[model samples]
Target chain A: MDSTYINEIRRQFPILNQQVYGKPLVYLDNAATTQKPLCVIDRERDYYLHENCNIHRGVHYLSQMATEAYENARRTVAAFIHAAAPHDIVFTRGTTESLNLLASSLGQLLIEENDKVLISAMEHHSNLVPWQQMLRQKKGQLLVCPMDDNGVLDLQRYETLLDEKPRIVSIAHISNTLGTINPIKEMIGMAHKHGIPVIVDGAQSIAHHYIDVQSLDCDFFVFSGHKMYAPMGIGGLYGKSDWLEKMPPYQFGGEMVDQVSFEATTFNKLPFKFEAGTPNVGAALGLESAVRFIESLDRNQIEAYESALLQRAVEQLSEIEGLRFIGQAAKRSGLVSFVIDGIHPYDLGTIIDKMGVAVRTGHHCAEPVMTRFGIPGTVRASFALYNTMEEVDVFVKAVKKAAAMLR
Target chain B: MTIKEIQDAIVEDFSMFDDWMDRYAMLIEIGKECPLIDDKYRDDKHLINGCQSRVWLSAEMKDGKVYFAADSDAVITKGIIYLLIKVFSGQTPSDILDSDLGFLDKIGLKEHLSPTRSNGLLSMLKQMMLYAEAFKLQEDKK
Candidate 1:
C-alpha cells in the first residue's frame, strides 16, 4: 500500500533500473509480458548450469534429475491454477499454442456442422483466430458475445447467446487489451447448464489473480508463463482430466507415444498426447520459480496496489487534453488503453518511447476490438506487482509531453 | 546482402512502370523493396484488402522466373514489401515455390511491426506466394 513497498518490489526486476532514451525506464507493458523476477532468471540459469539434460527415457542420473525437476514444475503450475490433477495440465509453448492445440484437438472433435463456438467480442486474436479457423473448416458458426458501451460483456445478451446451446464457448478470463476481468465463473456455470464446454483464456488473469479451475468449473483453461514473469516459450493448458483423456492426440512423434511400429503406432495418454517433441524444459523450470515468487507476495495486497495504480493512471491520463479510455469498464485489472486526440497511436508511442517509458502501442493483438471502437489502435500502460506511483507520475509527465509535441 | 547490390538492382531495372517516390517508398520500408506498378494498374482490383495503408501488388513471369511490383501508401509498409522482394524477386518459379516465406522472425523486422502491420504484410505475402505458385503451375503445364 505504501510507495516504498512498490519501490522495493521494483528492485527485484533488474531491467527496470536502466536508462532508456536518456531517462529512467517506466515499464507498463506487464499485461503483454511481465518482467522476469530475479528468482525466475536464476532458477532457469541454475537448471542449465547444473542439471541440463534431456528429460524422459534417459537412464543417466542427470536425465533422471532433469525429468524430476520438469515434472515437479508441471505439478507446481498445476497446483498454482488449482487443477484437479497434474495429468490434466499440458505444458505448451504459450497461450497461442495452447489455444491452437485446443482448437485443433478439441474443437475439431466437438464442433461439427452448425455447432456454434461462442467467444467474447473483446478476445485477443489468439483466442479468436484458431476458433475462427475451426468454424471455417467445419462449416460451424463463431458467435460473438456482445459487449456494453463500456466494453463489458452484456450478461443478459450473453444468456441470450447461450440460448443457442453452443458446442463450445471460449472466452478470455481477463481481456488483454481492455483489462476487464469477465464474470468467468458465472459464465462457465451458465454454459454448464446448457451442456456447453467452456475454454477460459487466462493469459491476462492467471498472473494477477487467483485461478481455481474447480471453482470456476471451466472445461479448459490456458495461459502463458511469460506473461506471469516466467521465461518465454512456455505456457500450459489445464483441461478436465476426463475430457483430456477423450481428446485425440494433436501432434505425433517423440514423447507423446506409447509404442511405434511400422504397421501401427499407439499414442500416449492425457497431457503427453498433446505435448510432442523436446519440451522447453528450462522455461518450464523458470515458471515453477515464478509460482514460488508469487507465493511469497500477498497476492491480494498486490492486486489492491495495482488497482490503486490503475485508478491513478486513469485519473492522470484522462486529465491530458484529448485523451480517452478505450475500455472503461466498472471492473478492471491494472491497465489503461487510450488513443490521444487526433494524434496517431504510433506517433504517440514513438514520442513516449523518447521519454524512457515502455508501453504497448498498437492493436494489442485485438484489431476487431479496435474496429469495434472505430480507432486505428490504442497506447496501453499495464501495471505489474512492482510498478510504483513515482514511475506512473513519470509516465503521466511523458504522455503530457508527447501530446504537447503533437499539438 | 548489401545495400549497394539492392540499389544497383533498383537503378538498372526500371521497366516495372511504378513511381519512384509514392509507390516505392512503402515497399522499401517493409523490406520487400520491389519495383513499382503503373498507375493504370492501381484500380480496386489491385488494392490489397485489410492493410492500414493502401497497397497494390502485381506479378508477372518472364523466362521461368517471377517478377513482382508492389506499391503502398504507408512509408514503413513499403519497406516490408522491399524486404520480401530482396528475398523473393528474381527467383525461379520452382525456387520460389520450394522456398518457405515464413522466415519472418529470422529477417528480424517482426517485433518492429505492430500486429496489424504484420497481418497486412502476411495477407500481401500470402497473395504473392499464391501468385508465384500459380506461375510455377503454369510453367509446369508448359
Candidate 2:
C-alpha cells in the first residue's frame, strides 16, 4: 500500500495519533485487542443516541428501527464470512462465549461418556478450557493434536487423531501466540472424512484473512469483534443450520423462547435460541460498521502489507543478540513472539512499554504453547492494517533499548 | 530504623534516578540483593496469585517481630519485593499491619501496583499484611 492510502487508513483510528510517555505511541498488541476506527465508534454512538431500544419484542417505531438494524448487523456478519444465511450467524459476547455456547450445547447434544473431542496444542484458553470442562463433566476424553517445535501443526498426526473418530474437532484458524495459520480447509476435509464435524476458532484469523465458511465447509466458525477493530462484547458464531437445529439452547430467557408455559416452553429457532439475554444492540451495530470499513478497503493489499510488517519485525528484532523467536512456523500471520536469552519477557515488556511501545508479554493465553517451547513466556508484537513500517522501526528500537538495559 | 524511616530512605534512594530506565536499573540491582525464600517454601503453596509472573512469599514471627522472605522469577518484581521486605521485615506485627506503603507511588513505581499491571506487587503487599494480621492474632491469644 502507498503512504497516502496507509495514512488514510491510520486516520480512521484516532487512538493512533496520541503520544504515550512523552514519545509517539507504537501499538503492537493487536492480537490482544485492536483499537477501534472512527466509523465503528460513530456507528455505536449513533445507535445509542438515536435508535437505542429493546429489540425483537416491541411493535413501536423505535424498537422496529432497532430490531431492523440489529438484524441487518447479523446479515452483515453473515455476508462478511459468506455464511449461507443471516440466521446462520449467532450474536455472542465474543469468541469465548461462542465457543462456550458450542461446547455446552454440542456437548449436551452429542457428547456421551467416553466420547472424544479433538483440539490442537495451539488453541487459546477460550477454545481449550470449555471443551476440557465439558469432557470432564461427561467423563469423556479430550485428545490433543501436537505440533512441531516450530509451532507448525502436524497434519499427518492430526489425520491420525481423526482416525480415532472424535465426536468433534475444534482448531484455531491462526494461533494467537505463534501466528501459525492452520490449513483448516484440508483439516476440515480430513475430519469430515472421519464423519466428525469441525469448529474453526477464527478469533485470530478473522480480521487478518478472508473467511468463507461455505468454501471451508466447516460446521461452525467463531470470532470476536474486538480483535477486528469493532467494539468488544459483540462477536459472531456461524453454525450450519443442520447442527444448530439439533443442539439445545445455550441460554434461556427473553428472546430465545418461542412460548413460555408452566408445563413446557418451546425455544426460538436458529440464532435467537443461542442469544438469550437482551442483546448488545449498539455493539452489534459497531460490529457491522467494522465490517463495512473492512469491505471499503482493498483487503488483499492490507493483508499483504501486514505480512510485510510482520516480516520486517522479525528481520529487525532478529538482529538483537540472544533474541530467539519462539514460533518459527512456515506459514505465519500478523505477529511474532520471541524472547531474549538472559532477559525475562516481563522485564523486557515493562521496559519497552516505558518507551511508548505496547507489546504483549506473557503466555498470550496459550500456556501449552509456552510449555512446548520450554519457556515461561514470550514478548509478542502483533500487527494490524493501520500499523505502519515506521511503527515497526520504533518498536524494534524500543526492544533494543530495553534488551540493553535488561541484559 | 522504623518502617516509616526505611520507606523514606527507599524514596531517597530512588530520588537519584532521573528517568524510568535509571529507576528500573536500580531496581534490578536491588533485585540481586532480595532475601530469597528458601527453595522448600518456593513451591505453589507460597505462590502469589493475580501476578503475570510467579512470586513466592513466606513469613514467620520470631522474637516478637515478623520477618518475610520472598522470591520471584522476574527481576523487577523481585526488586519491588525487596523494597517491601526492607520496610516490613523485623518489625512488630502491629506496626507491619498498620504501615501504609504509599511510598511505592512516591518512587514513581505506582503503575506496578495497579491491579491491571498484574505484577503481583499489590497481591504481595496484601499477603504481607495477612501474615501480620495472623501473627497479631496469635500474639493476642498468647
Candidate 3:
C-alpha cells in the first residue's frame, strides 16, 4: 500500500491522495469509476475556463468554436471504436443512459409478448436491467445464457437459447465482476445468424483493449467516459446508422427537434435525434482527451504489460490458501477478481482499505453472476494504465495481511 | 409531516444502518414494517424480475399519504427500500421532485448497491415519482 508508483498515481489524483478513515487511500475501484489523470482533470478545468459555450445553435465565434470542439470529440470517439461514421457515435449521459436509450426506443419497436431477450449471466446490471425493464413492458420472457465453470459463456447453452433466437441479445464485452472477456466475435456472428441484434456493453473493456466495430459487427455498443480516464456523465451509443435512423428519440426536448408544430414535431437525423439536450460539453472534451491519451500510449505495450501483471497476480493470489479466482478466462482485460474463503468481501474490502489498498467489494452490479458462483461477492482488483507491479505487490501483501486478521 | 420531522428521521434513523450487520437487521425490520405483497402482485405484471433478489413493490393511497410496501427476496435490498421510503414517504409531489438525495453519497452505503441494484433503487424512485405525478393528475381532475 506504500509503493512509489501507487504513491505517484495517488499524487496525480488530488481526490485519491486524501486520507480516508485516517489512512492514505488505496483505490481499487477502477471498475466502478477510474481516477482521472491530471491531464484529464486539467482538460475539464480548462474547458470550463476557456471553451465554455452552448454548441450547435450559436452564431458567434465561441459557439461555432465550441460546436467544432464537441463534434471533433465525436470523431475521436468514433475512430476509437473503429466506427464507420462519426454520427454513429451518439453522445449519452453514460453507459446506463446509453443502454436505456436503446432499450426504450429499439426495444419498443422489436420486443413483444413472450419473445425471448437473451443475455449472458455475466452482464453488468447496466447491460441487463434495460432489457429486463423493456421485456417486462412487452410481456416478454428474459432468458439468460449459462456460463461454464470458468465463467465463460456456455456455447452449448448459448446455442440452445439461440434456437429461440431472441429478438435482442445483449452481452458485456468484459465482465466487471469476474473479468471474463466474452468471446463476442463468435457470439455476435452466431447471434446475427438468428437475426438477433447484439449490444456489447464495452464499459469495462474499452479502456483495456482494442475494439473494432466492423470486425465484431455488434449492432449496438456502449461505454462510459469516466471508466476510461475521462470525466463522468458522458458516454456514447454506437448503433448502425440505419438502425439509429429508424429508432425514436429517447427524450423529447431541444436540439433533437427538426420541426415543432402544435400537432406533431419532426425529429432530427440519426444522432441528434438521440442526443436530446444541451449535452456534456466539458466532459465530452475530456473524453476526447482520454481517447487521445489511450491512443498516444503504446496500446500493445500496455496490453503485454497488463497481461504479465495479471498473470503474476493470478499466480500469487492462487497461492493464498482458500483463495479462488473467478473466471480465469485466459483472456481478460487489465483485471483480476477473486474471493478468499471464510472472509466476507465487505470485511476484506474495509480492512484492505484501512491499509490503503482499494479494491471493489460486493456484487459488482452483476449479482446473478455472484449467485451463479454461490458467493455473496468478491474482492475485485481491476488494473489501469498507471498501475505497476509494485502496486500489485503492495495490494497482495495487504490482502494477505487482511486474510490473516479475518480468516 | 413537517420537514423537520423528516430531517430528523433521515439524520438519525438511517445512520444506524451503516454497518452491514446492523444494516441487515434494520432491513429485516423494514421487511417487518412493509406489508406482505399479495400473490396477484407477484406475477410478471408487478414482479421486478431483473433483480438478483426477487423484489415486489405495491403502492396504495389511503387519504393523502401514498403508502409503499416493498419486499425483496434479498435481505439487504429490502433495507435499501427502507432507506428509500424514509426520503420518499409522506412528501408532497413538488417537494419529492425537487429533493436531491445526493447527501446519500456523503453518508455512504448507496454505493454499496451493486450497479444493477443501484438501478433498481433508481427505478423504484422513478416509479415513486411517477406515482406522485399520477396522483397529482387525479387530484386535478377531481
The full ranking of all candidates by TM-score, starting with the best, is 2, 1, 3
lDDT tens digits by residue: candidate 3, A161-269: 9998688888888889878888999999999988888888999888889999978999999999999999999988999988888888889997999999999999988
**lDDT per residue as tens, model 1, A1-407:** 98787777778899988997467888999998899989999999999999999898799999999999999998999999999988889999999999999898887688889988899999999999999998899999989998876889998989989998788899998888888889999999999998899999999988889999999899999999999999999999999998898888888889999999999999988778888999999999999999999988889999888899899989888788888899988889878899877666755675577678999877888989998998878889999888888888989988887676555
**What is the Å distance of residue B52 in model 3 from its true position?**
14
Chain B TM, cand. 1: 0.67
The 10-residue segment of model 2 chain A with minimum total lDDT is A398-407
TM-scores for all candidates? 0.78, 0.98, 0.74
Candidate 3 residue B15 Cα shift, in angstroms, is 23
Report DockQ per prediction, comma-separated.
Answer: 0.06, 0.66, 0.05
What ranges in model 3 sit over 4 Å off? A1-24, B1-142
Docking verdict class for candidate 1: incorrect
At residue B103, what lDDT does model 3 achieve?
Answer: 45
Better by DockQ, candidate 2 or 1: 2
Model 3 per-residue lDDT at A131: 87
Q: List ranges where model 1 is wrong by over 4 Å.
A: B1-142
- The candidate that wins on lDDT is 2
